[model samples]
Target: AIFSVGVSQLNASLAHRIPAREENILPTFRKALDLAREDADRLCHWISQDVSEDDFINWVTGSVRRMWGKKGNREVQAQFESDEGRRSVFDMLINLAGYSMKTKDILKQCDRVVEGAVLMRSLLKKVSHN
Candidate 1:
């Protein structure tokens, strides 16, 4: 009983030292989406003729590239660091695309990412306790 109590106390001390994970991805994602929408609108305005499929593709590519930049990547990394954040990421990925092979693949990958993050967090907690 004394040993277990000491172990628990140690674990508690270590856990307190570890900082809580942040949830910044959702807000960044929302901001990125809004910026993408605005950029797409601007691109549409610049066209003299009827917008074509190519134009739409360009807009999408540009917007995604902008959003997936350094800061956006950091935000995503922050989200993937936490269990709840992973769920938020998974939901965001699901809502971004419709029922398609790409969406399915991303969803599968997201599940793995979430599971991996949870496992890693647990391992960290255990290691800290030890």
Candidate 2:
């Protein structure tokens, strides 16, 4: 719940900082932002359910892959693969960790979460920059 709220706040901040001129943004970047918002909502929904660790890990991995697919070009893909991108994704997981003490099962999949975060960071960076 806390993690989802943080994600929402981050996304809102990004949306607000970007120019209102939609024409200046890449079509794929816009789609990535939309997908990210949807994912945050889904994460909230999932948190309320009695989901297994495996299921949660799958969702994390799949969502990251979906976001990566939204990369518009080589430049965007490269950005996703950059150090900043990796850091952002890991930071999200760190935030999640703070809220997971009550649900220790989720923490059991830390390795998987880290894998997904590596890919997710790129999508986050791409969306943030453009």
Candidate 3:
């Protein structure tokens, strides 16, 4: 759960650069950002379906671990915790901000990464019961 939000925030940070510096990264960032938005939606859906906070937390944590496990994007996954994880997130945020997005909304977007994590937790709880 924490990790998903971190990656989304990192994706935002890494995307703020102008094309002249490294044009290739822009497209990757675009794809990454799209995925991040999807994650947030998933979070909202999970939250809507659930009733227990502890179950929700475990679900988000476990779901994120499983998803990242399959995807094998360690750098992306690490953003949920650790020093390097945070550094990467900061780098992405800097990049995104450079691209002229509103600072406040961007921060909110970064923070909103938690929403996906929350949703992931909810989904897992549902799965375990069935």
Best candidate according to TM-score: 3
Runs of candidate 1 with Cα error greater than 4 angstroms are: 1-22, 49-130
lDDT of 3 by residue, 13-83 (tens): 66565343567666666767777787878765543443244443344356544543433234333433343
**Alpha carbon lDDT at 50, candidate 1:** 32
Using all chains and alpha carbons, the TM-scores for the candidates as numbered come to 0.21, 0.22, 0.29
Query: Which residue runs does candidate 2 get wrong by more than 4 Å?
Result: 1-25, 50-130
Q: Note the Cα lDDT for every prediction shown.
A: 0.40, 0.46, 0.46
Candidate 2: lDDT of 11?
57
Q: If ranked by lDDT, best first, what sequence of candidates would result?
A: 3, 2, 1
lDDT for model 1, on a 0 to 1 scale?
0.40
Weakest ten-residue segment in model 2 by summed lDDT:
71-80
TM match of model 2 to true structure: 0.22
Residue 123 of candidate 3: its Cα lDDT?
A: 57
lDDT of 1 at 48: 23
lDDT string, candidate 1, 1-130, tens digits: 1122333444454465455334544444455566566666754443322323343234224432344445433443343345332132233343233212223477765754564444334333333343
